[model samples]
Target: MKMKLIDRFGKRLLYGSVLTALSAVLSVYVYAQDGKAGIQEANDKVRGYFSVGCDLMYAVGAILGLIGAVRVYQKWSNGHPDTGSTAAAWFGSCVFLVIVATVLRSFFGIQQ
Candidate 1:
């Protein structure tokens, strides 16, 4: 008896379908005409980004380690009951960061 507004006008699905079709067509055209230069450039960019990330991670790990050491020292001097757990948590985080950075660098074969 009553017509719903959505049934009368709903273009979301149509728009998505059109957009997806356009992207697929564009990708196919790009792959059809591509030189190795583009791939090599992309690879170099990725390696540079990864190297920068590794260096940043190392710096972060050092800062964390220093802060953790100071906190652990304060707790130990006060003879806090949870000193051991606190120290373990802080040191563990620092070690984790350093280890992850190392592992990723090796895994990616990023020579710096």
Candidate 2:
């Protein structure tokens, strides 16, 4: 007796779906953990690394300041008409970076 190919395929598909659903349901009970614990762990990790993040921001700001200084000097020496605007933009960016870092740390109450 030859089994129909389509019937065999459908039976296999049904078996696979049942197995997948069973495994997923079992896993949910096997790996259940406290949500609050997970959230607290994440909070601790972020707080631990916050100071490093702030330091990196400060370093970036310092580098930008130096680059801006050199660029402004070049523009001034070359008598570029947009020198003033360029300088203002670069200065504002550096200040913004420092301010953001400070504000975030304060807002999050993360202390060094």
Using lDDT as the measure, the top candidate is 2
Count of clashes, each model? 0, 0
Tens-digit lDDT track of model 1 for 1-112: 2346565445666788899999999998898576677788899898879989999999999999999999999999999999999989998998999899999999988888
* Most accurate candidate by TM-score: 2
Off by over 4 Å in 2: 1-32
Global lDDT of each candidate: 0.89, 0.94
Worst 10 residues of 2 by lDDT: 29-38
Model 1 bad stretches (over 4 Å): 1-39
